[model samples]
Target: MIAVVQRVNSSWVEVDGKIVGKIGKGINILLGVVKGDTEEDIEKLLKKVPFLRIFEDDKGKMNLSLIDIKGEALVISQFTLAGNVKKGRRPSFDDAEEPERARELYEKFVKKLSEYVPVQTGIFAAHMKVFIENDGPVTFIINSKEL
Candidate 1:
């Protein structure tokens, strides 16, 4: 499992011109489930994301967490995050998990995150147009394999 987390002032996902999910003053998570990812991977990220101290404190230091600030979350399924471009010009998605298993884990991830904060999600496997107003332009790329 991999998560590309971006701190955002606001974010929303649209499918076929209809908005499906949206959030404000929080983190936008583009989650990818790769082959071999398991429940443990989801657990690790669930523990880390909310508590990550990326938000700024009153003193202007980056010490506040999403939970500390009572923020929301916008989670989106993004299988393309697993694309490999090391060889050919065309990206290969062989590392991505099958849709059924990927959606299962994706839902599990969102369920766990909702326990910590208000959570919104894009429709799984849909063609989505994401609009994000990045806060501090802050972002982090977390890979469960690295954890």
Candidate 2:
């Protein structure tokens, strides 16, 4: 599992012109499930994301966490994050998990993360237009295997 975590002033996901999920003053997560990913991967992420000290403190240092600031989360399924472009010009999604299993893991991640911070989610497997007002343009790429 991989997550592209961006701190955002606000974010929202729209599908077919209808907004499905939205959040404010929090993190926007684009989550991907790849081949061989499992619940243990979710466990790794759960132990990291909410406690990440990417937010700033009153002293202007990056000392606060999402949980410390009582922030929300916008989680979105993003299979294309598994795309490999090392060989051909066309990206290959051969590393991505199957849709059904991917969705299951995605939901589990969202549900677990929500327990730590308020969470909203884009519809799984839908074509989505994501609007992100990135806070300080702060972002991080987290992989379960790397942690």
TM per candidate comes to 0.99, 0.99
lDDT of each residue in 33-103, candidate 1, tens digit only: 99999999999898899999999999988999999999999999999999999997999999999999999
Residues 1-147, candidate 2, lDDT per residue (tens digit)? 999999999999999999999999999999999999999999999999999999999998999999999999999999999999999799999999999999999999999998999999999999999999999999999999998
What are the root-mean-square deviations of the candidates from the true structure over C-alphas? 0.5, 0.5
Q: In model 2, how large is the Cα lDDT of residue 131?
A: 99
- Which 10 consecutive residues of model 1 have the lowest summed lDDT? 43-52
- Which pairs of residues have clashing backbones in candidate 1? none
Q: Which stretches of candidate 1 lie over 4 Å from their true place?
A: none
> What TM-score does candidate 2 reach?
0.99
